[model samples]
Target: MSDDRRLKVLSAIVTDYVRTREPVGSRALVERYRLGVSPATIRNDMATLEDEGYIHQPHTSAGRVPTEKGYRRFVDEVARIKPLSAPERAAINALLSGAVDLEQVVARTVRALAQLTGQLAVVEYPSLRRTTLRHLELVALGPTRLLMVIITDTGRVEQRTVGLSGRGPDGLVDPAVLERLRLRLNTALVGRRAVEVVPVLAALAEQAPADERAVLAAVTDELIAALRPDAEERIVVAGTANLARSLDFTAIGTLLDAVEEQVVLLRLFTSEDAAHRDDADDTGTTVRIGSEIHEDALAEASVVSAAYGPGDAVAHLGVIGPTRMDYPATMAAVRAVARYLSRFLTGTEGSTPG
Candidate 1:
């Protein structure tokens, strides 16, 4: 049989199996799809597909199901991600428009993706190591205390308090010195990655005047600690009930456990080789089906992920469901949500929180 005709038959089998959750028989393929071929030819194609390990029969005298390799090929060769309708786009905008902060935006994104795809959604928080500084502020709260706020380009804000010494007779930080430090820190730190900001701050403190040196050093210490990367990254998950309905009862427990463990999920996203690199689109949307995902617990599940920030990936968001999912629809939803998230983080979408 010709490769093109064989692939066409395999595509039909995958589509039918995904939609009805049943193995596809040669007769059913002939009846349902316009293959322009006889049932005998279709049966021959099915036999060839089985020989190639693309489809397999689960029981005696039953139709065939697509294997992982078949699904991978179907996604790469036949699947075209469906575009969102006008109404669907409008609904996403309405749902995500009200988010006022990074946390709220992430929460809304996960919910929207889950609802759109009918699958469990996961959104990773922006990584401090990957995000650049947007702004920094210093405020005096009392005679011996100051507040340092660090904001990133991704709109994540972190704050820390610094205790001061060498106050004036009135027991207040000198306004002139505070203003100078703020200007210098902003000039040096803004647009730099969080991991690179600390050393710059320390250098700035060393060059400060004797009277302001202590305050600058204290603030530097606190800011460095605040910007340091956490041992484990954070992720927000929603729509776990969708998993219960779609996956086998025996596999749901392990899948949920893996989702609950942030470390495991983070590995799922960053498992460098696991991601399907489609150079066709610049969005970096990846699809991992069945065994492509290295985690033993998620062996039967599919993960559709996309990075959502400026430049390279600052964080990832995606959905998890059974391997027999609607790849076109799910990939489209994941891509759309990630694009909106990138816009929101870059101040191109809605108003960001104060």
Candidate 2:
């Protein structure tokens, strides 16, 4: 019973300190919370908690604040993330709906998360290696020019226009020939991963008729260009102004610089915390508090992120903020955004509840 009560005391201290941004005193906790303990008992519980390294007194005769260890314990102990209300879910769905392209979806997501959570938000682009081709489209712009459209399973669409004038002396590509090549490319490449499509494309080119050779070569070159980068090579960030509103932060300069670097922020989303992906207890959210983030710039900040993508292709998105932020509420917002984003990419809207 004392253990449970002490945990309650610790939880109350964290809650109050996060709200007030000041040391939490036993008296303040007793008045603000329903811990159902006497003042002396609360004080004793606080003392024991401090001794356990879960909390600290910042100055002589000051109230207590949770240490990073304490925040970790509190986060681990949370039984339920605060759920998004119906309107919030609607808002997220509305924001993400009708995004015609992958870039639009990512842009809307960052805006939605930053607006919802009032924190810096980031969404990393899906890695090409993990994405599969859903379709290959060839549209004849002119007799000797065609627009090549590559659609990935993750809803990433890349388009490039190629000239076939060298092959078309009369500046005319036979419509029948273009259609045949499109069909052949789709048959050989669709549903295959980016890595798996190269050899198949090369094989198609090797056996191609003279007229189709230029188009196939163009296809091969463009496809390789599209998929050559690392996972999350492009990340979109929003809400730096949210960080500007914070008054107590000491590492703001380094953190802002890291945000600009973008590659450095990947540690919070993909690299260092890669193995900690949750079992999708709703949205596979991962929370990194303070030192857990492993970046000196973010040592005083926290990151709450989730793996978000369509089907087997996954990328990451999250909010970056001071450790004093609301974990449950922020987690819910991140989860909601990620879930909606995955739905948008996969085109399976109603299969999962938001």
Candidate 3:
């Protein structure tokens, strides 16, 4: 069989099934799409495709639906991401510009992606690994307790209240001493990335007065844990209701469980394939269908994701839907959103929040 002609028939089946949400027939394929071949030829091609495990018939009387193998071929060999329309670019610019914080930026991106692609949208929080400390504040909550607030350049704020001064709550901290230590920490740790802060924290702890070393050590330990490479990253997801609308979702309960777990979704975005060496369009976007996801809960779903950053992927944005999704359109929206977010983060397009 000619690979090109068979692939053309498979592509038409995928496109029609995605649009109509029904098994597609060879007659419909010939009438709607310009296969330029006779129905008998299309039928022969489809039979060959099915024999090769590319398409399947759920019922003996019904037409065929693209199987996972079929969708994989279409995605890998046939689909080209549609270019964003001028209006789409304009809308993205208007909606994403003027965000004031990282949370808002992520939320807007997720919701926009959900709306654009009509799928469940997930956007990973800007990883602290790539961000610098903009400021660090220490506030006394009690004589032996303090609240530590970490502010990153990306506008993420993490706060922790710790009373681990080692001497226990009975041994009160001097107000003046706490104030001095706060100033010293901010002076040394501010303007440094997570990787750069580790050594600086160790030095600060090492040089501290004997009485203060324990407190500084505790603080540094917490910060180090927060910056650990294995830290569980957070992701924001919207359009869960989109899944409810689909009768075709195979394991709605389990898929919802996976969404709540988020670890599975995070791995999906931060997988080995997501990181790219350069900003080429082909290498940056990932399309995972069915068992390709390797998650049983997502066995009947398709995910389109793209990493967005200055160059290497500091974070990822993705759309999740049933296998019968508009691959080209979803890929286009995911890639476009990723590009706009990359520009925003690098201070090239949207104003960076302070």
Candidate 4:
């Protein structure tokens, strides 16, 4: 058989198996795909494929199934990623437009992607280490208590209340001192990564007047603490139940264990090495099929991840499903959602979620 014919036969087998969740035979491929080849010719191609390790016979009498290698080839060469329909695009906009806060946007995005692709979706929280400060506010709540709020470019807001050790003559945090410190903080922090803003804040506090130094120190400490990396990176996951629907009991248990383990999920989402090596156009999607995934638990699954944010600063979001998933539709949904999410985060598409 010609090499092109063999590849076509392989593609047909992969598509049929994905749709029916069953092994595929040469006769079935000819019948279902109109491959214009005799059963004898197709069987020869199947034999070649099996011999090359692209497919395997699960049983002596059963038809062939695509191996991990075959699935990888199908995704990279055969699958034509379909574009989202108008209604699907509309649905995503409707579901995400209502979010008024960063948390709600994340929650909505995760749910929407899960429902769109029928797979477990994971979205990483916009990292403070990657986001620039948007604004800062300080409010006096009492004679010695002041509230400090830090806002990031991604619409994340973190607030902390600091107590002033030394108060003004009027027994309140002096308004003049507070205003000067606020201006200084903004001057040093605005448009800078939250994690990198610490040293600037420390320098500002050190230069403040003696009477105001105590309050400045307290405020600076709170700001840095708020921006410090959490003990575990935050990720929002949805559609875990979909795994039960598609995977067997044993497979489901193992997959769930991997998902619930934050470290494993984090490594899956944050592909620092892949990110550095990715020289594809900015919009290209990342696909890891079966063994391409480093985690043993995910050996039976595929990951479709994309970075979403303005310019180069981004957070990862995507779905995990069995390797037999519909690659075209899943990839399109992942890419489209990432586009919407990037727009929403950068304030180019809709209002920030409340």
Per-residue accuracy of model 3 over 118-200 as CA lDDT, tens digit each:
89999987787877887888776776677889887667788877666565456666666677788899899887888899889
At residue 282, candidate 3 shows an lDDT of 62
Name model 2 segments beyond 4 Å from true.
97-100, 138-147, 160-179, 229-232, 266-268, 276-283, 350-353
TM-score of 3: 0.88
Lowest summed lDDT window (length 10), candidate 3: 272-281
What does the lDDT read for residue 42 in candidate 3? 91
TM for every model, in the order presented, reads: 0.87, 0.86, 0.88, 0.88
| C-alpha lDDT of all candidate models, in order | 0.83, 0.80, 0.81, 0.81
lDDT string, candidate 2, 32-113, tens digits: 9998879999999999999999999999789999888888888877535887888888778777777787889899999999
Ranking by lDDT: 1, 4, 3, 2
- Candidate 3: regions farther than 4 A off: 164-180, 261-263, 266-283, 351-354
Best by lDDT: 1
RMSD after CA superposition, every candidate: 3.7, 3.3, 3.5, 3.5
Off by over 4 Å in 4: 140-146, 161-172, 228-232, 272-276, 279-282, 350-354
Cα error of candidate 2 at position 159, Å: 3.3
User: Per the 3 Å backbone cut-off, how many clashing residue pairs does candidate 3 have?
Assistant: 0
